[model samples]
Target: MFCLLLSVMRRIICSLATQLVALIVVIINWYQWDKEVEGYIEHKAVLCEFMSSALHEAPASYDDIKGKYVFGRTTRPQFFSMLHRYNVIQAYTQKKEFVWIGISARPWFIGFAVLQFGYVSVFCIQLYNTVTRESWKAKTTVPLFGWLFGGKWVSNVHGSVGPTAEGHSVDFSAPFTGQSAKIRFVGGGLEFDVSGTVKKVEGLPSRKPTLAARYELSGSAQLPKEFLGLVFPLGPRRAAVVHKFSAVPLSRPLSVGIGEGVWHGMGHISMDYTRGLLRRDTRWCWCTATAPEGYGFHLSAGTYDIGGKSMENSFYANGKVALLNTAVGFRKVFEKMVKAEEENIDISSGDTLRWAVTGDGIDLQFACVDSHNGTVHCGVVDGNLNHSWGIFNGTITVNGIVYEFSDVPGALEQHNMRW
Candidate 1:
């Protein structure tokens, strides 16, 4: 009993210490915004920034940037608050803030996406918030007999709060510059406490991190509450400032607990952190995958092409990230008023999903094993979202190292929104 009490007290102290450190990091980032902007400008002007081994930081403001460019690797989100009003190129109707994390653990896959939109006009300011979570546990059995009596399970949880005057309630770290990202969300019977970390590969160029950046974290998640199947439906554009890090394998395995079942194993994690003034209507289709041997890739169309030199399409291998400089295409995808072209990938039409994605150095096929989908139409905001998980069979050659993988876990997503 005494030991248990001491352990609880130790956890409390650790929690408090973590929060205090996060708060301090936020404060320091807020004060040193200018220095971040300088680094962004300096790197943007260099033609070799994409191949530079030096670590870079996200700029505090896009006010001074002339054109769009890609970073060598995923950088911090220090300057995601707002675009400079005067240098506005795109007529953004609303401010959209989004963060998504996808995890792939063998026989079980989990994903979460949180989005907040603030529609500001001369008369009134409105806010719309939505959180979506999905988890799947694959069925296992004796070959033929298992196929006869199969029981595969999946859970979808969704929450769409109203057009309230209240401010944003989710507390997300601004800089997002750490080795591990902590994810904690609790509401209406759904709870999550997950941490994702990435260690720099040996022999890679050293990075110049910003002031007081910590690169280590540990975390866990428990989903004891029942899943709420509520649904509602819910985009804009200025420069469409976006930063995505894909196929980042966790240095440590992530353990997940769902009700009666507990899963503890190694898995790859990806992040999508973006903030910008945006167009009233937007659409996109995306796919990502991770192999057990630390291999991953990301592909998309109708998005991440916001008139910039950089794109969010790349593959991961040898503990390094290589950018893809080619056009991507999607097929059998829906678009309300916008037309979509399929250049690199083709999606088949049927009950099951199949994807044939090919590029300059990538040739891969994805077949769906299970899927989850939801739609929302609440008068002013509406959207269609489809998320699927399956196996990846193909090869990606980067830097002469051929990563030939088969039967690896991956996902495909398509979304169209009007807000």
Candidate 2:
């Protein structure tokens, strides 16, 4: 009885604290600065109009000054150069090499990283089998991240298969220095490679043109340092410049063997390279889905700066890209069991996880067959990443056209980090 009472009291305190924070944010952004948020929805609609035009314009590169937000589906070398020029010892930055390659109609995801913050240099590699729900991850940290000496850059990302109580493992390494449109990951049991070419837009094209092996995306967004810290009292502001590229439904033949299973099929590859001056504590939610006939969407929410003018939400179908201008919301339908002994729940049995991603013209439901949870505690750096893989079902109404989807292969993720 006493423990139950304590839990109730804790719940009350948490609820009150949440309400207080919401009140403060509303007062700061909406009431105090009335002009900024007047007709909020209508304002967002106008911004979306402007965004659509800008995407159509599709500037080749960002201006060197850096403050304005930009969007597009092509790579900008100037953005990469700008990130490398800014030096903030307290800030963290990374160039992530990520790929989601489909084999034999099955999905496999890979992640490799070269990151630096202060004097800490971190490298990471993650592999996931979406259908089987098996994952392998490894990371390492060193004192000195890298160096640029006499116009030459030098560093390396190195990792090995170590002792694991269960599941699979692999050893991998790649050069961390410089940028490359072509990337290769060589390891003890895996060989994967991707060749990328820039898709250039000569003029203001009505629709984005496809490339043989399109390999880059450029975007920028402003976000607050802490979760739900849109108001100044919570945390300072931060910015991120990102590059993404995709080659969906690759026509070329690809085959791979993992464990005792072998997969063979035409594959798909997607990659993201990000650089940010982020906060010490941050949290975000992200989801991605790839459907047949060149349809896919990327949805992300959490960590918006004051005014919330910049958003990262877009979907592409049949080679035409459209922006989702409204805010996105996420609700977890399958709750994680907190007290196993009392609840009599077996987490290993793999219950179907569900999440509803909804917005003005978007409604996406992701149902997971299996999930992978990872937690790392390396002193000051503590992180939790939960990933669930399954299918998506729902409808999105865009420009008066209702797009219906059923049983689309996708993944949902919840990530929290403190560094």
Candidate 3:
């Protein structure tokens, strides 16, 4: 009888594995059309040319960038609706903010992100008046290294609220995918009133986001013409257009506080504004930066979807993008950093996390020295985000010219999203 039960369990496990493999193959073919593949090679060549031209200097802002990364009439929101509105796509919109600051004069930082996708959103903000700044004690996640670690810690003794994410109460519009979005949330440690509009910027492909907010402060971005873009397949069909820029000010001058304390600081904010028709159980790697070279790189690959086709592997630098279909695995290059600090490193436990990128002869590596910042934890039937911004070092060889990074600051992330 025991043997029979074991045999049945084996069969079930085998069946599940087989189904999983089949799903992956379907996802691969979904985005891998011959025409698209052919176009990709041309796009890469154009991107590399732009990168080569501006390899020596960094643009002050997106204004200083120009290239063939412009979107045509077909790339706009209206064009998509007109073309595929006939039950050809399942649209989804998501807005996420990741704020990590190098507080005051100390190396310590405290920050979190508010993630909203589909009908669910998670507020990772401690929502507290003033969070205690400590580096020794692991905040929520157990810390790994000392000097290399950079993140915020929510104290347990202070009896502070962690993060809150659940089904929202607001009305979701029908398949809205644009830079103009308005939303307000009230409750717990999270209360926000903000309206985002599109503003025309000089010398750019399109009008990006100009945020009008109540807390923190107003912000804007002249998003570059080039970006990490992908078009997914049919049946619960998903497509994504994502742009990332670094902004700041997670909290304001204690204006909307519940208990009356102080909350204000400055750090790098990775504002990921995206419009997509997402599939279930999808995963992607997305990271960005604004300084030390005005770099913006992203990779979107996952399980519900395969990374092999219609993938997002574009790196933006000095206002141009270089396509890297296989550069998503550049994190492996970070192995050298780990080996150098072997005395204090331990990746087996996942305590010593890594974040990196390599492309078209350009490679970067960094480690999440500490894991103080809590997970971008989302609820069930939703997705979770894991990313950390920290100091890193490596050499980027553009056209064989080496530009070294010395403790340069940036971020790296992996997200698994569901709709």
Candidate 4:
């Protein structure tokens, strides 16, 4: 009886040893994988920072600047992030093994692990679809990841410097920058239907001066929901394809229609006016993109700098534009939260922009000017909030000029696809 009891005791000890060994192995493997993933994420973050910075320094229009910079400017880093999203499933699998190590300690571990894996897997699949140029069917679906995991994955490393150009008059070229693209839909009691063509005459490098024309009429009424529906869907990926025909000259005291097709969408506009000793440099830029389902699926990894602030800003479908402006104050609304239903933005211009956004659509309203002398442009309407895939609508008044517009493209399209 004593021998048998000792044998049983030995067996139990062996079993416990084996289990401990297994647990240790699992932990080591998990640690290694976790380190790898963390490294990958860090690398991606760096690349995003570099791209954003480079693009900020790069001229908005590559007109006079040689196409060499445009071409030579490497997008390989951005492409790397795209590739990572494709491999995310494999990455998650490898990472989840580490999660299993923790699972052995608690009953809830298994459920948590499974849930995390599933969520990450879905996100990876959607991200892959977005980067691979799949059908637009998943456009709204993929941005949902942004709503779910945007804050965790992306860092808001930028912010807006006070007004770069407000009230100061300057000539605006055809909108070349995606964030800066302007579409004018004239409606409401507003005049000055000034649209003309200009050719680049001097101060250009390798490329020839191009000619562009702008034609718009402004009057205001309650903007139609149908038009709002179309316009709201186009904001996030807001972009335009400029067919260069003639050299367009933008001189001071000039307000040239930047884009030929004026499509207005619901988003934000920022103007900076600064006084300097040598000369006055004014910058007027607006960022508008569509978020149909309230969040975009693909991640925007790039660099941007308007004037004083250089940082990374990411726009999610949750009606939130993450501004990583180091020079200006900003914040991340949702952290570790799955989805955001509403977003309220208070701009430095003392304007409050509010959005009721969801996975299905978005409703946006802001205060603009009543006529053009900086009054209040306010109204409420509903449309496709998933504008990140190219849709959106809104009425905007810049210095008292009112425009009712729709169907403005998104900035993401410019980075990922050629539309």
Q: Quote each prediction's TM-score.
A: 0.52, 0.53, 0.43, 0.24
Ranking by TM-score: 2, 1, 3, 4
* Among all candidates shown, the one with the greatest lDDT: 1
Q: Write model 2 residue lDDT over 1-419, tens digit each, in one string.
A: 99999999999999999999997886555322212222322344444533343433333222336533333222112222122223233332322212232221346544444444544544443344555545443344444443221111112232211111011122122354222222322221123342222222112111122332222211111111111001111111223444333324444445444334445555444433343444456677877665554556667786432244224455655444565667788776664533323322222354444679988888888876444455668877688766555568998787898777677666667778775
Residue pairs in clash, model 3: 149-370, 238-277
What's the C-alpha lDDT at position 310 in model 2? 23
Candidate 3: C-alpha RMSD after superposition: 16.5
lDDT of 3 at 323: 53
- Tell how far residue 111 is off in model 3, in angstroms: 7.4
Backbone clashes in model 2, listed as residue pairs: 217-244
- Candidate 1 local lDDT, 1-419, one digit each (tens): 99999999999999999999998887666433322221222333342543453223433323236433323333232332334442211222254555555666565445555444433111000000111122222211122221122211111232211111012123222222221123433331112243322221121112111222112222233221111110000111123545455555554566554333345666566555455554456677788877767667777776635233226677665445676776665444323322345432222222334667766677777766444444558766687666666667888887777888677766777778886
Worst 10 residues of 2 by lDDT: 223-232
lDDT of 4 by residue, 31-50 (tens): 34312221221344444433
Better-scoring candidate (lDDT), 2 or 4 = 2
